[model samples]
Target: MTTFPIYQIDAFADRMFAGNPAAVVPLDGWLPDIVMQNIAMENNLSETAFIVRCDPATDGAEFHIRWFTPTVEVPLCGHATLASSFVIFNILGFDGDLVRLQSESGILTARRDGDAIVLNFPKQPIVAEDIPATVTAALTDAKPSATFRVASRDTDFVAVYDHASVVRDMVPDMSVLGTLAERGVIVTAPGDKPGIDMVSRYFVPAFGIDEDPVTGYMHCVVAPYWAEYSGKANVVGYQASKRGGIIDCTVDGDRVHLKGNAVLYLKGEIYLAD
Candidate 1:
């Protein structure tokens, strides 16, 4: 029998039940991919990240991180990444200030900063495209100001608008959304708030998630777009998907700086009944 540690962490939530919740499971060895997917489905949360093979002292010491949802495995996940790092540093007795991982998306890093976990992610390059039928019907009232495509693991739809309120208060037709893509849709806009440069939401029916709380991979895309539009490298961002989050980001060439806070909610062990 094999046993592992499991955690229910609230990412971007300063307190319990306020931000997005992702399950973090620490494993010493690999678990069957099917089992990991099953665990995520059982958790029924937006995302659950499994960490196997950790070595804090090694060059890539944090762990090999993977994210899963009720329906599928994802290459990148922000809240789960934060939750995983929190469990490693705070709950698992690791004292390291920085965590790095080998993931599907590529090499990623997370650092402990007082109350939050900041992530260093690659910026997804954006090139303008005409809004397609898949995008036009998903959003009801407003037409997108600009559009971009991210064809990493799956083709993603990136929509930008003029107002954050529109982005913040959007209610999508999940039934139609679910049929669109495997990666979901990201609709964003510039906020009127002086200090806040951008606001956004993520909808992924392809991944079987209606919405995501705080997406780390998103900064990879949002940062560069906002950086150019705002004419600054730094950006103050917010994800207004029901359970909102605060993300501070900046663009550096093809890389992005994603800074955000995370809180550990529950911690325990997982026994593999063998």
Candidate 2:
């Protein structure tokens, strides 16, 4: 049997059950892709992050990271990246405040910001698009005023609502959502509360997630959109899932800094047949 350390963390939250939960596995070497996929399926979470330290003499990044859903691998995952960083910074006795990771999405960085971890990710591109009738019907009776498609490697649709309640109270049709061409759909609106600039909900039935509690990658899409709409460089987002979370986003030229807190929920070892 091969024993592997595994950590379950609630990302984008200060408490145990208030954010998106992700499983993080730190590996000395890369595991087989099928093995990683099976582990993610076993965990049955929105995402699982796997990390392997890069050779210090040859690589610029401290580690190489990848994210997996229950069914497939993803190009970028924000919450899981944050969770992985939490383990690295807190549990692994890493030396620095900033950790660089090489991923399919490109180079990503996480830094300590007092009690929170800030993730620096590439800003996903957004282009105005016509909302599909199927998407409109799947969400709710209320129509979105504007819609856009994230033209990045991880494609998703963004629907802009007029009110936060519309994004919060939605009970989307998962079966219909699964049929969309994009990876997922993000519904967002201007925040109704003080200190929160935007509010959002994420649905990705196609990725085996009916609803993501707190999505870090989706914020990369929404933060820039809201920044443009609000005419501000910083936008604070609230994900209105049942287990809600708050993310602070700062939009730079081509990057977005996502800041949030993570809490450890479970720490154990996974035993697998070798």
User: Which regions of candidate 2 are displaced past 4 Å?
Assistant: none
Worst 10 residues of 1 by lDDT: 53-62
Model 1, runs deviating above 4 Å: 54-59, 151-154
Q: Estimate each model's TM-score.
A: 0.92, 0.98
Each prediction's Cα lDDT score?
0.80, 0.93
RMSD to native, candidate 2: 1.0
lDDT of 2 at 256: 97
Taking the tens digit of each residue's C-alpha lDDT, what string does model 2 give over 150-199?
A: 88753788899999999989999998999975478999999999999999
**Can you give the lDDT of residue 46 in candidate 2?**
95
Clashes of each: 2, 0
Model 2 is weakest, by summed lDDT over 10 consecutive residues, at 148-157
